[model samples]
Target: MAKTNAEKQKLYRENLLKNKSKYDQMRKISRIRDNKRKKVERINNKQSSSYKSHQSFGKTVKRVLQSLPKDIHKCVSVVHHIAQEFNIIPKTTSHHQREQHSLSIELKQLVMNFYSQDDISYHLREAHQLFLIEHDHTDAYLSLGSFSDLRPS
Candidate 1:
């Protein structure tokens, strides 16, 4: 014969009392683990979101800078294309002046042929920072940095 309601209630009370002391500890550990999991998820979400924005922001800046008017002097592949073009190549900077190096005549003509004085100067000033950042050779860096000093000779 199966036990009736009274016996079932009596058994349930005994089991609850027997494990009561450990119940709170188990609950606390479960809660802590859940909290850690939630924290990690939050951090991952934040990192992914910020990383996406940073990559897109960099591309946007490059596109805007490269597509500006009167950028017709040199072939602009990207934001730092001008810097890499002159800096990485060894023979680009032909010689040194008193304090600064000079770009090859061909290179000078390439840009000088297309732009007016004011526009060319404006482009150089704006692109100067990129050259400084991307240039490898000291001569190319010097030549590009001091381009405005070059006369029409």
Candidate 2:
């Protein structure tokens, strides 16, 4: 036979308290794990994000710089071709001097070949900054504890 209504209430209260204690323990454990996981994720996220742009820029600059020597060689070949056609080799000009002079002339001509000087300079400046940052050589950290820190840029 079923218990009286008063007895059922007492049983219900006892079960509720037991389950409540278990639930509270579970909640505490879940909170601790969640906080730990979040802390670890936050640290990893910061490490990955901080150097991403710097790394990207650094890679691009390195690639561009690497190809530069090849481009310079090509330019030198072109200058040699032109000089040979005109028979204009100087007796005093060493091979190094010839290369240097040709490079200077080629650079000037190439700058003119561009649509504008500002465009080339802008790209060069950005590439240079990326190269610097990528090398982990940004001097801004030096300014952090220096007098420059106090001055407004």
Candidate 3:
């Protein structure tokens, strides 16, 4: 009877060892399920923020203009106010000029973002700021600053 019990215990241990990979697979599946649930929760939280749209200033302006009747000045005035507030520096003939200025500012902004702290030094950054100031891009630079809270280095 003792010999039979010992043989049975040995067989049980072997069976558990043989099924170890199956146990690992189940653990992996469970972890994947939990991670997927957490990811969904994170996405839901992000969707609750005010940043619902991803668009350029030019596109946003175009959208606002299109939404209003073509003959109205009040809505245009509101758009102009938004443009001025953003420091696009609205002027007479702004319907044409605003697009050009905004495009130019956006281009300069792309160039600025190309420079990073790792590649640029103090002196070069100062020179770049001075150049922008001379080129009448101080407003554009400030607008960029407003986006990321960046300051002259």
Q: Model 2 clash pairs?
A: none
Backbone clashes for every candidate come to 0, 0, 0
Task: Report each candidate's C-alpha RMSD, comma-separated, in the order given.
Answer: 21.5, 29.2, 24.4
Q: What TM-score, to 2 decimals, does candidate 1 have?
A: 0.23
TM-scores of the candidates in the order shown: 0.23, 0.22, 0.22
lDDT of each: 0.59, 0.54, 0.61
Write candidate 2's Cα lDDT for 27-63 as tens digits.
7898999999999998886753434588787888688
User: Where does candidate 2 have its weakest 10-residue lDDT segment?
Assistant: 142-151
Q: Write the per-residue lDDT of candidate 1 for residues 16-134, one digit (tens) a residue.
A: 66797776676788899999999999888665344357778888878877676555554443424655666763333434547644567754554455334454445446454543454
lDDT of 2: 0.54
Error of 2 at 126 (Å): 57
lDDT score, candidate 1, position 30: 80
- Please report the candidate that would top lDDT against the real structure: 3
Model 3 lDDT on a 0 to 1 scale: 0.61
Question: Relative to the unseen true structure, what is the C-alpha lDDT of residue 113 in candidate 3, on a scale of 0 to 100?
Answer: 64
Ranking by TM-score: 1, 2, 3
